[model samples]
Target chain A: MNAGQKSARRIAASNGPIPRDTVCFSCLHRLTHPSRRPASTAAALAESPPIPSHQQRHTNPPVTTAKAPRKAYQLLASPVLSRPPLLTRDLTSFEKAYYLYQKRLNERLALPFTRYFYYKKGTPGDAEWKRKIKVRKTPARDIGVYAAYGDEGWNDEVLVGDRTAERESVVEALVRDAEGKAIIDEEVVGDENKDGLAVAGDSKTGEGQRRDLTKVEVERPVGRVTEADTANDMRSLSRKMDRTLYLLVKNREGRWRFPQDRVYGRENLHQAAERILVQGFGIDMNTWIVGNHPIGHHQMNYTSGGAPAPRLAKITPNRLVSTSRDRAEYEQEEYGEKVFFMKGRMMTGQADIGKNEYGDSEFRWLVKEEVEEAVTGGYWKSVKDMLAER
Target chain B: MALLQEVTSTFLRRFKAPPASLHRKWASHCRHASTGAVAQETDELEQSSFLQGEGPAQQAIERFDPAGVAKRRNRRLPPSRYQFRSPRYYRGPLHPHQPPRPSEPSSREFAPGPFSLPRLEQTYHDTLASDYMVLAYAHLPPGQTAFKKGERLRRWEGDSPYFKNRPLRGPRGGDTLRLLRKPVTFRNVPQLQRVTVHTMSSDAINSGAALHVSGMVLQAITNVRAEAHEVKKSVAGFGVRAGMYLSLTCELKGEDMYHFLSKLVDVVMPKMKDWPGVKGSSGDFSGNIALGLKAEEVALFPEMEVNYDMCVRYYLSPTFRIWLLANS
Candidate 1:
């Protein structure tokens, strides 16, 4: 071959079709070498590091027969961390409270736990969501506060006014230092912590700092509330809600409404509970979801699949309890001066009626008894705690 | 109103919680009173089955077979017997909160989306506690170091969306590179299509949320080598995007990404605030959300495991995403 074309090829004696003496197309031998060139280009490849082709270095490690610790070796030995050795020393109530308080404070700064909780009643407004990065609130609950419960001025339960941290700590301290006999203020009504003995209340503080209770203000669950408490309890309902209803069930009080069409297809809780009051709530407790619609004032909606069928019909006013917290207001809002008639229509394809979650037939009060029975025998607030056993 | 409704709904879920008191009472009584296992041993010596027995304790165990056994495995449980005496007449968070129709929550039917939630702080975390989801909505500044999973952040009662602790697979490889054991999937993909027809009062609503997915990293470099014995570089920041391989299936009529996303703020929350995942360190959760959908909705769409690999990148991660699910 001519010198010009000769540079493109190579010959390998051991490797057949290729000659032993040849340089790569880009080699200096190809560009500027003696025409005859060296017999082999073996020196070139030997000195260079070969780049790996397509295979990835480590998509996964080689599956080794030798095992890893698997879990913490100690964890493998015991699985669970042994509880902190229970103290050998008996702790007084105050000591226990102090321990719990210190533990909680340490926990407060500990990580992440702080990011949760608080601001539970409503979703932050658009501007608020943008401006308030700390935490958020629930929309439905907030709407209720605005539309109906506005400024009853709660200082205790919610974090609306501030001094909340001090309040929390002070409460913690009280739990640490206060004696069981400390009579609670009437203001210290609800048990802040589940322990039935402890009551957390807000003392009026215009300056916004936690203040100690006036000694004999502790509230306790008396020997046992009347059959009302029992009645309320047996049904998974509570009487605390009466106060809220006392405030909302009115033409003047605000309303919490649901989308009108949503009344169907979804569950109506009030009627279901009424069914249970007449029948009885079964094992699988029924629950309800609430939301707001602009239709009107605070309105209640109930839904549940786990409800029992109603046993009675044509409930009358005489059969109803008038002094109920809920009844007095619901009657006024529902009937008004003009008087709205009891309306009824099927919930489309809903099957077996009488109070299952998807069951149809929302009540249109035909008589005063039905309305009153609904209010007095209706579901109570305490019922929300079926899980509070500990 | 929507926010309050959601919290109320969440609060309401506790209404359905298993009667801890009842469970505890029944468990303690049944467990203590049960000499049955011992009695059964005695009966075997006499005549199996033919002897037949009677006792309230034995009967109680029989009455609460599955449940009692379940509580037994994890002791110190809530009462499993009798629910609150009678809730037939209860209403509102016991009264006024009720509405004509309870909202059909997507959360009720589906499990909360799993996550690599980190509890950077120890005080807020316990190795064994389980809680229902806690959802907290916050308006963060344009920049405030995206909160890490395990970092301590202040919160209020009933404020967080973190629900419970779910053991998950951690990351593998070295500390620098990690991976979840299984492809962490999102069952709640927001369906934007149908969201519009829900007839939006749509008002001017701005919302943000914090959802906590509790799981351990499938394979993680818990202890990495810095030198020989090695000093671990304190975990700085971590983040997981919505998908390392997120796939979408919102082709159906009304459900699309946006529609579902809108609803996400109110539902699907964390059980606790800023909880850390197995790593026990909150990784900054921030990311571009990629919607995940069920395969039945469309054959053409891919799955979350393979599609959403990008979700867990190291250090710099996007913010927490709100996943709205149509059929989660």
Candidate 2:
């Protein structure tokens, strides 16, 4: 057995009779031994001065000893749950111009349209298509360098006006006109009904008109900017359409940080993170922890009597022996706390933090840059690399 | 530029040739013309004169109706006259005409599509990939020595004369060398390489029906053709004879692999009666994971469910072994 375990056994033997309700000597031995502690505690011990083999007996205490070992640092699991971008990032003006130029070049180089393949001969639809093509007035297919300088080429001279301006296609314009007319007809019908007049002929004529075969019906795409974006609503998940949004909450101390909770008894970091989400935001938001491991970590030392404790430096064996007289004072120092941040993805739903639950706390969905500004300098330095650039 | 120069030079030469030589070339071209001799003559005449009057050709073009032509002629049109047929076998690079690569549409072994991008693939590209890189990262302080690993192959240490020039021994406990895992970066994130679905049925040795059924079921579910493998050596305990076709395997890649995985995870696995999950210890140390499916579980697939009666008639109960390999 190691020196710590042997010392614990010797102490227990000298103490003689133990209470029945209390923990057995073996359990106490396991808890008191530094070698038997968890990996995190073992790592902490590795950085501290090693106790001389002869001093091992005095370092540990028996059951009758009033003072217990220094309390382990409190661990907190902070989960940074985020929503991925809904839309692709906006294109720059240069990109827009380049794409348009490439598109026009593609059209010029493409094969000549074979009208017979798409439309039958002598039909009204074909006639309409022919008229539309005539209006477009595309140049005929030609060979050699002359084609590059032709009127249809993607040249600065040909496109002297605003090059990147979005021009409505023929089909889009036709669709828009049809929708406008329908809306106007509806308004007219509503007015006639209010006046108690029967305009049957006009309604019949409007309904009798057939949809244009050559004109395609295109649905206008939804706008990228939402109400949340316009109002600058930091609480809304839909505010940023093209950037990753992280959920940050204000703690009782009024510090802005990621949603976090203390690591409870016998629970791992990821499990504590899962519990933190449900307790802080209720059982509504659907968030998934990416993995069991922590993505980043931050450590803070507690202040003692209004002054920060001296930072611990690596102590050599010779130096440790020389200062053995002050070992008691060194052992009593508190190491403060460590927070392990776990990465997660918020698939759906929002954080519903009840006022009574969190005690006047608030939550905001912030992007990378805003998060950096919201948290402290040290906190941002620790987590800046973990956040996605976009 | 050289190709363009060659083309222009050849064209100028052909254009400036003597009348006698031009006539000779035309005669040779007509000789090579197969069934379109008349059409070729018409095309030459059209090229000779760019301007023409309002003739019968213009009237015929105006009157042309494809639907009427198709209705009047009730038979299917003849096969395309000059359609290229890719070479069946690859001769060599030195051959006059080599076969096209399998990626080309005309190649004999070409397999098309990736017709649609799978949702899982899109999610991987957007999120999982970067997260994985960050999770696998390990930071080291400046001026620190890198971690050194012990030598894998053992060296001879004895002073014997025979040991002086001997080769290093294989790793302890096993002859196989384990794959080295490099630090994950943006370019080297782990990704699914391919999936292999394998099944061996001893019943196939006794009857060919079992083999046929297994092949059909595998192809139906995986969207890839299954290849039958014959037993090289007989195993008495397994009750198989040499040279008997006893196994079928289907390898899926790209779109097919994603579709199969998504379907299995989203639909089939959840429908199973009592499956917990693929065990945590299912993967080989080298990054390939295997999962087995019972006969009933195999039947849970949507493709098999559609033709459940047909599969039941043949008693399709071969256990499926699926292996998912990842590129690290």
lDDT tens per residue, model 2, A1-390: 345544444444443433222444355746466576767546545785665565555545444532533334546789989898776565444444544444345445445654553356886546645543333344221111113334324332122234332323323434443332221122333323311123344655664333332433458766779999999999999998878899999888988989886554446778878777887888888999887888889988777897866444322122212333332332222366689998888988888889224452999999888897899988887788778755
Q: Can you give the lDDT of residue B241 in candidate 2?
A: 76
Q: Write the per-residue lDDT of candidate 1 for residues A1-390, one digit (tens) a residue.
A: 233333333221122222212333234234333344433334443454542443223212222222222111000000000111111222233334433333333222223322212222344322332222211121211111111122221111222222222323335334422232211222333433211233334544332333345443444323323454455532112222211111001111222110011111122323322332222212232322111111012222222365432221221122223322222221111211111111111111211214323222232211122123333322222111211111
Residue B220's lDDT within candidate 2 is: 75
Name the runs in model 2 displaced over 4 angstroms: A1-79, A83-245, A248-342, A346-350, A355-361, A364-390, B1-102, B153-179, B236-239
Best-matching candidate per TM-score: 2
Candidate 2 chain B: worst 10 consecutive residues by lDDT? B32-41
Residue B197 lDDT in candidate 1: 14
Q: Which parts of model 1 have CA positions greater than 4 angstroms off?
A: A1-337, A341-390, B1-314, B318-328
Note the residue pairs that clash in candidate 2: none
**DockQ-derived CAPRI band for the predicted complex in model 2:** incorrect
Interface RMSD, all models, one decimal each? Answer: 29.7, 19.2
